[model samples]
Target: MSSYYEDSVTLVAAKEILASLVESWALFRLLCLSQNLWAQEGCFPIPIISATPGSVIPWNESVKILCWGTPESYLYQLEILRNSTFEVVEKKLGFQEKAEFLISHMNTNTAGRYQCQYRKEYKLSEHSKTLELVVTDIMNQDYTMENLIRMGMAGLVLVVLLAIVIGNWHSHKVPNKEDWPDFPELSRSKHKCQTGPLDKALRDTRALCGKAYCKPGNKKTLPS
Candidate 1:
């Protein structure tokens, strides 16, 4: 009967009983009190840990992690897998002291995921939930003005070639109508600016006298 009572009073078993209840500040304080009260009641300290996964770290930069736990024995480490299958693994130690790691460059690959591993002096602690980071080519311009210009010129050439193939020709016409002559209107305007050499040849001789066309020695009229 004593053995059954001892097993029932253990701190591990006590915490297990507390786990079923919703966690809150009051509940946590009660469980802690129970653990302290049961120290003479012969039980190991229940392990507590805090870590963040599902976070993102950009490529080509340092990855930083933070982890804290009770009893001061919980040591944290961060690691990454190079390949998709995790066939290659990279690990580090002492994240509680220094939580930063640098990403190594690869020839082809761009993105990867990181995870935190915590241990109390074991080779592998339960790995954290995975966090993913994205990598991109800083060199490539996605949409450039030069590329758009080239595409537009190519499309214009293609359209012109198709029009030629479809038997279309454009008739040429000048815009300013005054630049082209109107012969009848110019001849009949009866202005000083309208006199021309070809028109002078067709006029009757009985018109009003002009000194410009008069013979030099025959200017005087004979009783007209």
Candidate 2:
């Protein structure tokens, strides 16, 4: 009786050990499957990123960056790196499947490559393809053109004003009559207060007339 009882107890203990081993193996398999599923979900798809108004943007213009990912992803991270300096310029976090980042005014400093990644629970997805951003000097270009136009207009105005002034000055000048050449007919009437043939003839004629006209009663001789 005692031997039979001991064998029964031993058999019961063996069965319990087998059951525990089976349970442990099943749990291990379940844990592995869970981990594998999580990893597969994390790596299935990558995020997609794009820039609004194209990659090349004008200076001082607003720019919008969009990041898209699977709906399962509850969080996203956006990053920007400047190619010239090889430095990270921005990092942003978003809680939605789609994220948007806005740069109010794009500049040289804000121009570079961009990327994004998604996270679900503790797993992170691969970063999206690189998107390049280029900021152009549109403002400077316009300003230079405007300056040239203004300069040209100013120069033309100055030329016109100078021409008008020259014309007015020429028109206001008065002619000097003394600078004119003398006429032959007017030379005889002109007197220089010097004794000449004309003057002597006139004096003799005046004396003869006085002598002929004088009467004896006057007796006064005409002075020569």
Candidate 3:
């Protein structure tokens, strides 16, 4: 039978090479219980951190942070992630390879995430990525809104004043008919003056002249 079909195809290639060597020895025993196995055997380097006046702060002020590491390191540590693990908080012990921490009056429960590590004698390293932090202010926005409101009010007042002035001017610009003299009365007074006094005087003078000139129904002779 072809030697039992070649030993069942060599026992199915030796069970696929013993299941790939038990999945690489269980990933090398989970990286030897990991503590960042000396930065995964690159020999320790992974430390860095940072935060000094940045990472957005403003509630109560004060920060610092910093980390660096690896010049033979020494100790360091720093953590702070809460509710999801991290913890630690402080340790120190370095110097020329940096370490600092500070954190004075912060607030809002000290913001959030952070990290840092280092050790160097029995090796530790790896753990500097996270950072986050934050706090804020809205004073600027408030000032801007207030200024806009003031400007709008001023403009409205100016418009109202202008309207008042225009209305006043219009009221006085036209004349009122009642204040003028009547045209017909003026014309009648002028006609009366032209036909009065002089006419009466001329009539009286004619009468006197008529009487002196002759006696009615009488005749007279006179000798010189």
List, in order, the clash count of every candidate structure.
0, 0, 0
- Order of the predicted models by lDDT, top scorer first: 3, 2, 1
Compared with the true structure, all predictions reach lDDT values of 0.52, 0.80, 0.80
lDDT string, candidate 1, 129-203, tens digits: 665665444455366888899999999999999888665434354537876787565444467657688668656
Between candidates 1 and 3, name the one with more favorable lDDT.
Answer: 3
User: Among all windows of ten consecutive residues in candidate 1, which has the lowest summed lDDT?
Assistant: 43-52
Best-matching candidate per lDDT: 3
Which residue runs of candidate 3 sit more than 4 Å off their true CA positions?
Answer: 1-107, 110-113, 116-125, 129-132, 139-142, 172-224
lDDT of model 2 at residue 131?
Answer: 91
TM-score of each: 0.30, 0.47, 0.29
| lDDT per residue (tens digit) for residues 1-224 in model 3 | 99999999999989999999999999888887685754556767778898987898877788998989767778898898989999988898754488889888777788788998888877677798999888665443347778899999999999999999999999888677986677755688687678767888887767765663445654542223
Name the candidate, 1 or 2, with the larger lDDT value.
2
The sequence of per-residue lDDT tens digits that candidate 2 reaches over residues 1-224 is 99999999999999999999999999999999999998787564888999997898988898888888876677777777744443434455645668777888988778788888778767878888999898889645658778899999999999999999999998888757995678665454364554699888988877776674565577666665
